[model samples]
Target chain A: MARKAGSDGSKTAEAIRAAGLRLIFEHGYEGMSLRDLAQIVGIQPGSLYNHITTKQALLFDFLVEHMTRLTEALDAALAGIESPLARLDTFIEFHLRYHLTRRMEVFVNNSELRSLEPQNRAVVTGLRRDYERRLEQILAEGTRSGALNVPDVTIATFAIIAQLTGVVGWYDPKGRLGEDEIIAIHRQLVVGGLLPIP
Target chain B: MARKAGSDGSKTAEAIRAAGLRLIFEHGYEGMSLRDLAQIVGIQPGSLYNHITTKQALLFDFLVEHMTRLTEALDAALAGIESPLARLDTFIEFHLRYHLTRRMEVFVNNSELRSLEPQNRAVVTGLRRDYERRLEQILAEGTRSGALNVPDVTIATFAIIAQLTGVVGWYDPKGRLGEDEIIAIHRQLVVGGLLPIP
Candidate 1:
């Protein structure tokens, strides 16, 4: 609510959120302290409250922003796509890349999410569901249009996501295989199996 | 190490470890105390100390025993299977059942293993790695035998595991689908995708 320093406030908030995210990922939410975040941000602990009401608030913000980015990105990826097969490919590729670029942040959303209080958890979980819905829609469209063969769209959506998101656990920037290479293999596994038999 | 009760210390140790597993699964290790575990087994906390030195040690024991069960189950599932393709299906089914039975315990292993001390973490992680190596073995066998088709066995192994293991998050015993149906779907996803096209 403070919203001080115009653009400076915006920049500082992002910086603080990044630091908080790292601490939370390394040490569970209960383990991270506001003082640790403020010290990392090089600001008075009181000044931190100006940007976020509490540490939990910052966590919620990270989750919301993370989910929002995913929605917008997926929407952008699927824009004006007509072919069901193409839509499915875009869905897998977008999900994989979104996770790769936002590894730590996305991992937190996927793993530490249950730690949030009920109210905050609902908001975060709702947003994640929204993202999952996109995949469900793609699968539904693909099946209806005969572009794919899947038994259950609901199960397929979770399977695809869990398969793609595993990248965060093992994907290393220094690794020999690039992100695109990994994404390519993922696309092959999903689309190759899901695409209708010729 | 704790032994049995009733003149046999080994049995007593095993009972304590079993009680500890159920308690820790219901409540995260951090949330459960030695006292809670002892009470569940109808013993005093000091009695627990005679069996296991500390809560941390108890956690390590549960983890070791649980992981061993997982590995042995998976390994047995693949036994005497000559075809890498059939072996892969057995492997996936094993995971589906394992997650369903020990749902909470699996959740904790994936989520709370990082909370363990360095030494404990190493041992638990090694057990997990042994399970992971089984995944790699399936992929390697299939590729070497020219039975299954995939871009890279490495990515395929990780992708398949993530998709299969992710079931613990959403699977409900009261759900419409039965265990056999769910396992069938996993077989389709893994076998359908990996086996060479007809």
Candidate 2:
């Protein structure tokens, strides 16, 4: 019975996180209420506390978890890539593919930073910086190796990430272009941008 | 006395719009209340109706006003630029400069589309497409002249706009790079990306 209860508790916690993401996505963090969240999750308002401490904590958790998984997945994708250019290509494709399917999470993550408390904001910002540093390092490596001609690694890092991530804003699964086609086109833009004028 | 009343009414309406922008920027559309808006504007709740009909109307007004101004400004900036390359460069620079100074407006415009009613969203989306078509035409012109090698005009349009508009997110007037310098770096990334490989 104790084991069953433990499993049920974990399940409820997972449900809370999922529902919180949807609520925060539909309504901004400030717009969503605990009562609304509880109702959506089919739990009593009081039982919500059993799963999550507070709304702020739930948001902080969502952001931290998203950033953490993003960086980890990126690392996995880039594991075997040796050349700087190849690594850069992998990074672009990885970012696009990862973000394409997680539109709601990305939307909430981008829009809700204002609602996070200062300390929580700092933690999430640090995680973001860590993720950005991964790309910056790749760009820096390419610049040093003479394989690429990035005017400034820092600027290129931001520009490339922004360009790639923009796909999430407009990508449609039912659209004419397939995911692979979209990735290929963006890879051309980014990789083509970085390559030395031949 | 009637003339004075008209002037005061216009001033109050302007004040209401300004306060509404800030409120929507700080709190999402659903999160902001008419009472809060009236409080910030130092008017009674009843007086808000004198300036704006409904919260929805106020948000619609803000979006329409923003999109209108953005496209008009783009048109003005691109005027007299004959060459497709120059026009594209001007578009990038103008988008960055225009968005950088209006961070709050841009943030609300991008993030609050979700809060818009479907009809209002369609209207805003149409305006956005009109703005995007400006770049698409430029890309197509360059492609036709063989001066630029855009893999796909539509994809390039989205990618370049996203790359440029992203500056608003992280731009710091006090940062090491001046606005011109930042613009130049992105110009290199964008224009260089489109130039045929030598």
Candidate 3:
């Protein structure tokens, strides 16, 4: 649904997206209802059609927007970082910091893949692969330059991404450890893991 | 509900649990319905009550059973292993292998915690803490012995477990890499991550 920028329609669309993310995060995608979503967004139940075509579309939008922003932000973070090792350090910090504050989006993204329709799933999966490739390229370049000892680039990519994203599961903004401290610990683990053993 | 050992009633109860796991896995806890569960189990809709008390109870049971089996298996795997490094290695291998086959249970366990009642959530959380503590203790021991250069036992433990458990997310039993190869790659990532830098 297209709407004029800054108009009430666009504002309502944004509100719907935000509420959809929260509902999908708390209840799995299959469990979120349009009625409840409309209620939460303070719209009549039938009026949700003005913003989203379907619940499936809402989920797809969330995932696509998330992956797109993630990759774009990562690119911005790594620009002009020439060396593979330095770029890798930057990637780790960027990923950890980005994911730390977006726990709900991350949770919904990971857990809702099964709920996506096949074609939509493919699009989201492709976006995810694109994201993964960013890390894999970093690891592969590091391996080639003799700056890192990643035995298998693909496995290392998945392993490192998983390890970094896992921070969201336990990270608390108010927790004892600050964000920098958490990132520092993970940097040591990930970068330290890939460094060739002397 | 109590039944005689090896009775048909017990067999039916087992079937109900298995079917419940698959249903809750495919559909989230809230999405799963008793009617569908009964149909899947080949019982009349009303007959589901004979075996399971409520959908919430069934979910609670699945989680409790999964956690109980997981901790027991971990204890068995770690038995007679003395060295902290060896125990950590054993843990990586054990966790990888155990989670590899029980993908559904792990998915439901990780994703459906919100659906669990507060008291049930507390029990499951405690079980999870106990399991995490097992690894934390191993890291602490290795750290104290100067064998492992873990800066923080708790953070290291969470990172390693997340890295290992992630195998289940992408593991294909018939995929190119065999189980041993997967375990070896992860062992390198995890153990290499913790060793004191030269």
Which digits, one per residue and each the tens of the lDDT, describe model 2 over residues A50-117?
88899999999999999999999999999989999899889988999899889999889889999999
Provide the lDDT at A16 for model 1.
92
Kindly state the fnat score of candidate 3.
0.60
Which residue pairs clash within candidate 2? A198-B198
The recovered share of true contacts, given per candidate in order, is 0.43, 0.60, 0.60
What is the C-alpha lDDT profile of model 3 across A34-121, one tens digit per residue? 9999999999999999789999999999999999999999999999999999999999999999999998998989888999999999
Which whole-number lDDT from 0 to 100 does residue A41 have in model 3? 93
Give the DockQ (C-alpha) for candidate 1.
Answer: 0.48
Report lDDT (CA) for all predictions: 0.81, 0.91, 0.91
* lDDT score for residue B11 of model 1: 71
Candidate 2 wrongly placed segments (more than 4 Å): A1-5, B1-5
Q: Give the TM-score of candidate 2.
A: 0.97
Name the docking class for model 1: acceptable
lDDT of 1 by residue, B1-69 (tens): 674456556777888887877665544566567787788787877887788988787777778888999
TM-score of 3: 0.97
Clashes of 2: 1
Task: Judge candidate 1 at residue A194 and give its lDDT.
Answer: 82
